[model samples]
Target: MLSDMTATTLDVPAELPFLQSLSWFDAHWRELTPYQMLQRYERGWRHRGVTADLSHEEAAFLRGLIQRFGSAIDVPA
Candidate 1:
């Protein structure tokens, strides 16, 4: 059924290095709080030359991440 599957387009606000976005709690990721990481995430999304679309299972997983902490990501005035 591989040929019958349709690809879905996902808009990930930010793209992490080597798909590091999935490792939200890794020690390196822990270095920055969710708020801090979210800030950098927004910035990266803004200037990222590569497209931020993930049309696969990871896309669904990352969307969950955004939904989980998106409300808390804020930039200072």
Candidate 2:
């Protein structure tokens, strides 16, 4: 006999405080998954409507994460 399996793993931050604070997350409530939240946070999609008050380290972390994730996406020149 044989068995079939399917699984996926994502490298999400252990403590995503900023993501937890988003109203969209609160409003949409159950629709957003951990991976979707991580993707949105990395792409700066949450920053569009509001001004972010990030510290130097936070800004740098976001930039690094975006660079790592957004490498697959094309950017306009």
Candidate 3:
């Protein structure tokens, strides 16, 4: 029974088309500047606990965006 329960991961593609459709800052925290994205993410993390609404890839993308563009803005975690 245990042997039959092996976990399998799906290779889902990134939501590039969905992203492309959205305008800049589509949502309140959608695709604003990297610093703003980081700021909103960090604020959400602070108030609501962990990233319940975000997927692992989305969270990682936010971090990468900050590192790539908002490295100088030091928002405390």
Candidate 4:
């Protein structure tokens, strides 16, 4: 089973299409910085107590996003 931290971090990509389709990026793009999103993910991971098991595609997507946008979220050491 994946830990809560992992699940929360992985959820970002899954929500990307919906966020974009809703035009959230255009309206609140400034307010929704990558760092802020990472912070939210960290908090969510702490709250959920369970992590996600990412598929290969999901992993690749996240890596690409991180490389493109830059992430402030850090995996637990």
Q: Could you arrange the candidates by TM-score from highest to lowest?
A: 3, 2, 1, 4
Model 4 has an lDDT value of 0.43
Pairing residues by index, what is the TM-score of model 1?
A: 0.34
Structural similarity to truth (TM-score) of each candidate: 0.34, 0.35, 0.39, 0.33
Alpha-carbon error at 77 in model 2, in Å?
Answer: 19
Give the whole-model CA lDDT for all candidates, comma-separated: 0.44, 0.44, 0.42, 0.43
Ranking 1 against 4 by TM-score, winner: 1
Error of 2 at 2 (Å): 24
Kindly list the per-residue Cα lDDT of model 3 for residues 1-77, writing each as its tens digit: 33222222222225423222332345543434444444555544543323244445654565465555454433333
What is the lDDT for 52 in model 4? 44
Which ranges of candidate 4 are over 4 A from the true structure? 1-51, 73-77
After superposing candidate 1 on the true structure, give the runs of residues whose Cα lies further than 4 Å from its correct spot. 1-15, 18-30, 50-62, 71-77
lDDT of residue 35 for candidate 2 = 37
Candidate 2 residue 73 C-alpha distance from true site, Å: 11
TM-score of 3: 0.39
* lDDT assessment of candidate 1: 0.44
- In model 3, the runs with Cα more than 4 Å from the true position are 1-28, 48-51, 69-77
